[model samples]
Target: MSNIVKKFKVENGKGFKLGDFDPAYSDGFKKIEARKTLKDLIDETFDLQTELYAANKYALLIIFQAMDAAGKDSAIEHTLSGLNPQGCQVYSFKQPSTEDYEHDFLWRHYRSLPERGRIGIHNRSHYENVLVTKVHPDLLLKEHLPGINDVKDIDGKFWDKRYESIRAFEKHLTDNGTVIIKFYLNVSKQEQKLRFLKRIDNPKKNWKFSAADIEERKKWADYMDAYEKAIKETATNDCPWYVIPADKKWFTRIAISSVILDTLKGLKLKYPVLEKEEKDKLDESKKQLEKE
Candidate 1:
């Protein structure tokens, strides 16, 4: 196994434990260098990802969960840019539609799960049930979970149950064939404010800014609580969450890419082999063409 793969072994079947792995632990200018290194790692990983796709032995499902302006879109755009479009699919989870609300919370998510021999990216995944819903309890009106109304501590129990459900869902995916990698872009509040302000001030980025984003910021503490608990409770070794430090965009990108590359390397993927008869036939054809 490669060093990257050794660094990302699954522990206790719940979460991945990176003991001393720090992709962005550096000073001012050095951090920039680290980011570049990370980009290279991601590029290399995509090379392997294409091979894995061709091998058709396993599927990769990447989940990106982060607060607003935490660089989720940028990470996905840049990190996955090199992957073959046909082998890669990206799903951006938005507000649940009426039809989405009619089904269970995991309903929409299940539909987007990656099939065998492909890579699927989820921008904002089903964890919304625990994160966004916890922040805005009103959203729960869309789904009907028993005991939600009856429980006095709705926020606590609500998220706990959701975490349990998410764990089970991921375990099922792992048992079948999908390799699940969950990332939490842990951007500081100060960094988020700066990003949000940039979005507001820049004319080109204005369209990306929404007034409701500020409302969400007001409940930052609640969201943090929800995220902390969800990660702690549900980060099994089978499908673990990587809490990426996003204060530096470059570092965040590299760290993410390294983690991803590590995961793919561990899968021990390779190009498919042809049968001896097929190789002999190809060799014979080459000899016949040469004679012509």
Candidate 2:
């Protein structure tokens, strides 16, 4: 296990306080130092991922949930660099489409799960059903779940039931060989504001800025409350959430890569063993090739 993993992990997530974490925390690595560490992490991941692909047993699911400008995209781009693209799939969940609205909240996410021997990365995941929806309960009417027409009746029990659904969903995945690691990029409001401004000022990044992002920023407290409650309800020993500081993009990238590499290494994966008959066949084939 990596020493840094525990530093960011949300153990016994119930009653975990988001306030206890610092979004600007960087483990004392300045940008240049962190960039060097990031390179090393990316290099080490390729062999580990090849082992995972060869072992063909466990699938890894990485979930990143964060407010705008928290650098989820950069984290995914930087941390997973040099990974075998064939062994990985990344999905970024956006607003639910009409098709998404017709199914259970987890259905869309379920379709994107990684198969055995692969890594599935969710830029934003099913947790949105709790975090964003919890912050904006009005969005629930769109789901059209049974017995939820009256928004007034949608009380604590409704959210609690949703939390139960999330727990069961993750537990089911764990039982079926999928390992889940959830990350909440804890970015400060001030940092997010600065990032958003950068996006606005930079021509290349102007399109990335959304008025809705600023609108969402206004409700940061509500989102934080929702995140706290959802993490409390759904976090477990099998599927843990890591709230990583994101004020420094470099640090976020390295920290995330460390957790991912540590998780993959901890699996203790091995290549498939060949039987004597298989070994003999390979040796014979090698001899025939030598003759050719």
Candidate 3:
């Protein structure tokens, strides 16, 4: 892996701290240069994606988790622009429905998995269960989980179990054919405030602003603690987490594309080779088409 992208990977998240990363990091690449670099990365990823689909042996699941105003949407849009929509599936998870609450937290996400030879993108994925719910433990009541009927039931042991479940779930996916790549867009609180103000200031971006966003922002420290603990618990070699610098949208997109390209390259994907009989059949079909 290139050193440029390797620093962001958290294969073993021991002592991982969000404070250690700089959200404004650009690695000396200016916006103008980053655009071209991102384009090249996307082009290569697109080619590999085609081979991944044709080979039909693996499924890539990309999960994005971040604070509001962290530029997750734009990063995904720019980084994956070259992919064929037919071979990609993107899902954004928000509030749970009545049916969703009835099943385990991973249930809905499990159903959304891409078939072999496709890339599945989760805008805000299962990690939210640990993140938002951890911040607001009262939300757990909605799940109707057995035990106590109050937030007091959610002790440290409960959180440990939840983290264990996440680790095992990801392990099972990797044991099969699913390749999981988790990304945490690490935007600074100061940067988030600037973005919030920009959204409020710009008429075009006003719709993106919400009162609840402010409410959530109030619990920033709690969210950070939750994220830090969750990442430290679940990050592993098979399904590593990439804590990307997201203060600058251009740099965020570039860094994300680099990580994606590296992951796809490691897969060593190639178009399936035809057997002798298949080659003969193709030659015969070619001859018939030519005659026609």
Candidate 4:
């Protein structure tokens, strides 16, 4: 675990520090080997998750946030590939609809929360209440938070209050047996530009490119400030955030898999056992079937 954490540097309010991994020492073959190892670990983790689901002990909520081309989709597709589809659900939040805007910020999000004994993944989640709303103050007018209408320096206070609300909301969920793991895919600006260029150069990927994305890139600094503040304010022990380095795809996959495996490990799940009478009945049934 320590070796995995040392591979990437994670940054937050406490300041930047090396993660439990050092990927630089790993060559291409070594990285591939690590990914293969991660695949096996994830398979075992899914078995545990299935057992945990049957036990109805808890629900797992994973949130993924990242800039365009940060491998958010790929990370999820690969890392969660081993889990049973029935036990997992994925929701991708796009632009808000009129119905979505009609309610409070978390209304759409709460609607998608996982049931007991299931895993829910949010592609881009309710944190957008702070991130996108900060970038475009006009969006707040759509939220309709009471008392926010007349507040002075409303931009700063609005987000501050929202952060507090989010923290409390997540705490309530945690208290109710939901384990939340938030991930922020940190990619450098240079890498983002290269990815954007790739979209232009490739015909199939071009469908994902948008003019609005370019417009958003101009506010990169503003978005970063919003992300930095939101992460610092909302991260808590019960619902901690894992900042993942998105430079190398294999490293990102391994880091995500490790974090998820570690989180699930603490659940201590086991398959349910049959009572003595039930076991005897099963043996008799097997004997009858064998005679047939």
* Maximum-TM-score candidate: 3
Candidate 1 pairs with clashing backbones: 13-237, 13-238, 14-235, 14-236, 14-237, 15-235, 15-236, 15-237
lDDT of 3 at 67: 97
Q: Please state the error at residue 259 of candidate 1 in Å.
A: 0.5
- How far is 89's C-alpha from truth in model 2 (Å)? 0.6
Error of 3 at 8 (Å): 0.3
Return the TM-score for each candidate structure.
Answer: 0.86, 0.97, 0.98, 0.88
- Runs with alpha carbons beyond 4 Å of true place in candidate 3: none
Q: Tens digit of lDDT per residue, candidate 3, span 8-109?
A: 989898888878988888888888788788888899899999999999999999999999999988988888888999999999998999999999999999
Give a tens-digit lDDT track for model 4, residues 156-178: 66677789899999989999998
lDDT of 3 at 31: 85
The best-first sequence of candidates by lDDT reads 3, 2, 4, 1
- TM-score: the better of candidates 1 and 4: 4
Determine which window of 10 residues in candidate 2 has minimal summed lDDT.
1-10
lDDT of all predictions, in order shown?
0.79, 0.90, 0.92, 0.80
Backbone clashes in each candidate structure, one number apiece? 8, 0, 0, 10
In model 2, which residue pairs have backbone atoms overlapping below 3 Å? none
Give the alpha carbon lDDT tens digit for every residue of 1-292 in model 1.
1433333333443433332334233223366486567667867887898788789888899999989998999999878877678888999999999899889999999999988889999999999988888777877865766665643447655666777888899999999889999888877788889989999899999999999999989998888877866776777778877777677887677667778888898899889988999999999999999999
For model 1, the stretches where C-alpha displacement exceeds 4 angstroms are 1-31, 146-158, 288-292
Model 4: per-residue Cα lDDT at residue 53: 88
Model 2 Cα lDDT, one tens digit per residue, 161-228: 88899899889999999999999999999999999999999999999998988788899899999989
